[model samples]
Target: MELRSSLGSVATLALVAVIVAMLVGQQLGQPILLGFVVTGSMSPTLEPGDGFVAVPPVLADDIEEGDVVTFDARELQGGGLTTHRVVGETDEGYVTRGDANPFTDQDGDEPPVQESQIVSVALQFDGELVVIPSIGTVALALQGAFGAVIGVLSGLPGGDAVADGNVETLMVGGGVLLLLYSFAADLLGSDRGGRDRSRSRKGATRAGLVLAVILLLILVPATASMVIPSGVNEITVVSSESPSSNPTTIERGGSQTVTYNISNSGVFPQVAIIEPASTGVEVAETTHWIWRGQSAGTTATIHAPDETGVYYRSISERQYLGLLPLSVIVALHAVHPVVAIAAIDLVIAVVVTVVFALAVGFQPLRFRDTGRDTSVVDTVRRTVRKWL
Candidate 1:
């Protein structure tokens, strides 16, 4: 009898909470987005599974330090939101850190989280997150599942690692259903003769508008290559179209300085990889070589020694993203001195990858590592900037 009463009380509390949540969600409308505490952002202060009643600042004045919060993370992109503790604040924005995180965040000045970008904060804390530490992994797997399904449904076939036609159909069908529901809700009203005609017209307009939006989403990514000017390689890598003259004297053995006029033939940034023609020509120990942006370059060292009987710099394959082989991998040639052509391609890939890493949550080298890793089975980076 006591246990039954306890269960009844719990049920009543849950019902009240649900009613309150619905009221809050309806009143706040867009700013108050719902989320659950998956991990310990507040740590001892807050635990897992504690569902948060997140609300964007009613005004910027509402923001204060120590309030567990959620905001947009730009580099994370794609509707990504991070909920963390506001350790400090600047005139520009709030300084946030997760309880689990030792470092505050990557940038000295955290990205000024605009009010428009904020999702709601948790006001309602029940217990903790659903899955715990293992939850993030599950979320990631779900994303991969959605991404893979989306990839296949769009008619562009993706990797065999995740090829399920049913999954693809489900994702697309679900999206269509959601859009139709939204459109119908917008057109809901009385329908009688003239009123029915008006409703039909409104419904047509809403459906057309929704379909147009869906098309825009699909076409924007699909036709992005056309408008965004993809594969428009701005960087010119000079592969020795003309073979070099063979010289076998010590006049060139010592540290010899030569000027390489690297001109940016394309509209994009260019990169060059210079190395010895083969294992035969040694780039004398402590031999210095480097190139800057324009005609006059800087100081640097060559990556690979003389091998493959060729020395040339080509735009990183990564620059040519549209081209399958050339964009990611130049060529797979197993030659002596381990001068693999694909390895040379990596030097270009790495340089471009290192530029804007700090802005994003991930370090640049780490990201370049993905493409570099894929090629690792067959190659390595042969470059002037060895690890950059």
Candidate 2:
């Protein structure tokens, strides 16, 4: 019975962790481990409220035709992330189409989907999608509840200050509170009448589960902070003989410097690197260290073509938490931004795991047997009343 109960607890915790990941992924607009469709574009295969396991591009094998991928769509649904099946390969990119659609995306305004734009691939087994029915519906309902709570909190006295903070920050705070409440409820409801119960109750598994939850609470927000704000910044420039005061207007055959503000609104200090993404743009300073809730600026020089014309240029920024040395992060980022993120996450997980293991070795946390007769529900009610 004890072994079965322990297994049950572990399974419950795992389910909760997956649900939390899905919720965070939705809020971050990235498929952390799962992705879902809001429309019936993939109906019959994956219904509108269904979700599927998403393997990040970094971890997944090479993309191939017939694979369902989630990519940054250039035209479909007004240019956002879209999930569709790869139908054909071209020199330019891959042709994609919704499973239920009669025509490929290229038949419309959307161009071929590039490999770089693909974020995740839906996991499949035996050529069938691993679907989680109605998970998206549950996630959407929870998100709506979060928004409602934020609205209510914003209306309270001095609550606007709290409500105005980053949504991810609020989410982390709420998650912590929820965890604490769950622990409290579990503690209050546990039966403590029999001495045999105390002898049989082994808490090593529970302790490990708690530690896992704590680690996730740390990792999810840290990853989001680095990812949510980092992306390409596109700037338009008009090169002409008569240059205006606008920094974007450059004299033909000359150069203009524009300032790009880098801000860290998260709770942790961050190190950011900005690099030129186009030929005409060059960053004056590629790296910056920013304290939490602070901002910094970097300059990018844009050279106008000899022939007067309007042009577009871009710069990309990648950031990581200031947990590791600047030089190490820079070296890892040189390989790929995702590499740096993965390394940082790995380090954090290792350090936290070691600390937890040292602090709470595998042992049963036995409670004293009090000779009082009380129903579990009554005990919980009494505990709640005392807190109130």
Candidate 3:
């Protein structure tokens, strides 16, 4: 029961923190998203009942044709909001059209969308739009409930007393209270003879020193590599076709040659390797070396495996210090990019968690041998002070 309570408390605390941060950022006029889809104008791209996670728009010059954008359409027909892809750009603004629509918005009597009307760009992950389906339904339900309550309050004689919008403040306060409650609970557990009583001061000091050394060893080289300047390596695929000049299509048990143009723009010469590995599928492997401030052209023969599926061509630049190689892998499947990055992230998280647990575990125990009163309030205060 105690373990369950502790886990529940951690989850609740994390949820409250996230909510509070979102609300605070929204109130501060950040480009934080608080929108839900109600229309299907962008069907096949964004469906009805989808949730939007709005990101700050790129510079107007950076907004290229075919980019999906969300904007205010209050003055347009149907009068609410709209998100569409940019079809063409004009001197006036952007010519927007929905992916599933038969014609452009201009064809429907709406003028070209001005840059001033643009709100934000819908965020994309792994080259695909980020969307959470069915979440909009929950948002709509909450909006309806709030509207009904506000309507009732407005109908009352002393409406001003209840109609004030303090929801953000209330949420922030609730989050703070939740944090305090969690801290108090931890203190209470510690006071109830939950601490180990056999550890010595010398042992604790030695354990702490070892933990610090381990952390420094892991962090120092990583930090130094970032600060140090390494040669810049650039790679561009010149062609992926064999002698026939036709597009290279890898069928079952086939081979193809891909030519690449590699360049080095820094003081030192760089080596780039094209290694084939199974990141969901098998890819062809090759390598090349380029001189400083010069370019090199090389070809690699890629062999397709017997089983047919998607594949990847991983281009990696080898660094001098022998750290992890910087890689740019072209994949046949888009989700493979997200999966590749997420796998690396998961490994780092696991490593950090294990190291942290070991470091904390090795710390000497607090025996609670003193005769000083271990009352709930006193324990809570001590815990708060220690954390602070």
Candidate 4:
């Protein structure tokens, strides 16, 4: 029972902290993701119960050999948090090993994970491990109870898959319940007592400001920098054939016919137009095409030159037909990482700021007077604070 109360206290504290952090993220104009570790691979570095901060997967491959990282380690037999050192890379794939392990991991019989397998990398500071050893096990037990609730809801007489927005609704409702607990903590667990109410309020205010700064600068920026770009990433179009064309010594207006297939696998509505990038290359007049919109799948003709020995724009690959639209043929376009992430982060920051302002404006009143409480309040307050 003491453990349960402690767990509840920890959870309530973490929740309020996270929400406050998220609010700070919006003020600084960034995305915020509060993530917890579920694995013990990092051990003393990050106990299983502790929460770690993560920046998205953008420059994760850029993570150096010794950096601690959190990535989509699902293919390594199980999924969830994995903190490991990037050991080496062969033509096949990267090799990774945990910090405390005696030996490097043998590839788990699965194919060498491609670069896309990574999710995000977490950078933890010196000492934030607050969850007791394997405290998450108890948290998971609570989560398991919640899972049972979901299963019960799902199989009820006229129920649907807990997917009909009940999950989020329940979460918010649960948060509302927790919010009362948080206020109760503030009212009762004042490290500084009634004798020093002014000091407690002052400390709380300062702590709030510091938490705001950390959320805005570090946490929000990192999460926004990752998630917002993901939408844009989904809208890429690659030529089925390698988008690369060799430098050609060719004459103007001389036709060099190259055969290529244009695949628009992205969600955006775009049609491939074979435009001439060089003075020597010409757009083939025969190559006019209309894709039936983004999802209908359209194939376009790209011409390569024959003279001054024309370079044909032929990019074809039958081998990558399985992925549907995202082919091995990559187009060359230069966008700096800083500029790209900044653009999306700016947009997300705007949305987050608006919502957060509303939440602040409508911040709920913490408590209300129930008319019949004065006599009981002093007695219980004295009892609770142990002030005889």
Tens digits of per-residue lDDT for model 4 on 267-344? 332223233322222334312222333222223333333322212232211111111122111121123333433544
| Each model's backbone clash number | 24, 0, 0, 21
lDDT of each: 0.39, 0.78, 0.52, 0.42
* Model 1 regions more than 4 Å off: 1-33, 36-61, 74-80, 106-117, 125-141, 156-173, 176-388
**Local error of candidate 1 at 103, Å?**
4.5
What lDDT tens digits, residue by residue, belong to model 2 across residues 41-152? 9888889989999998656777888899998887798998888999999755689989999999999988677655777899999888899899789878877776777677
Highest TM-score among the candidates is held by which one?
A: 2
Give me the candidate number with maximum lDDT. Answer: 2
* Tens-digit per-residue lDDT, 1-388, candidate 3: 6588669767876655544444433333333454445678788767887766766442222566776776656446665467788899864457888888889987776666655456567766665877868756765554455456556765789765544656544343444455566566656556434343233231123445445546656554443332223222222122222233442456556666666555666554444444432121222334445567876666656555455543333333322211223343222112342333333334444576587776567654343434653543455466579999
lDDT of 4 at 217: 62
* TM-score against truth, every candidate: 0.27, 0.63, 0.39, 0.41
Q: At residue 152, give the lDDT of candidate 4.
A: 73
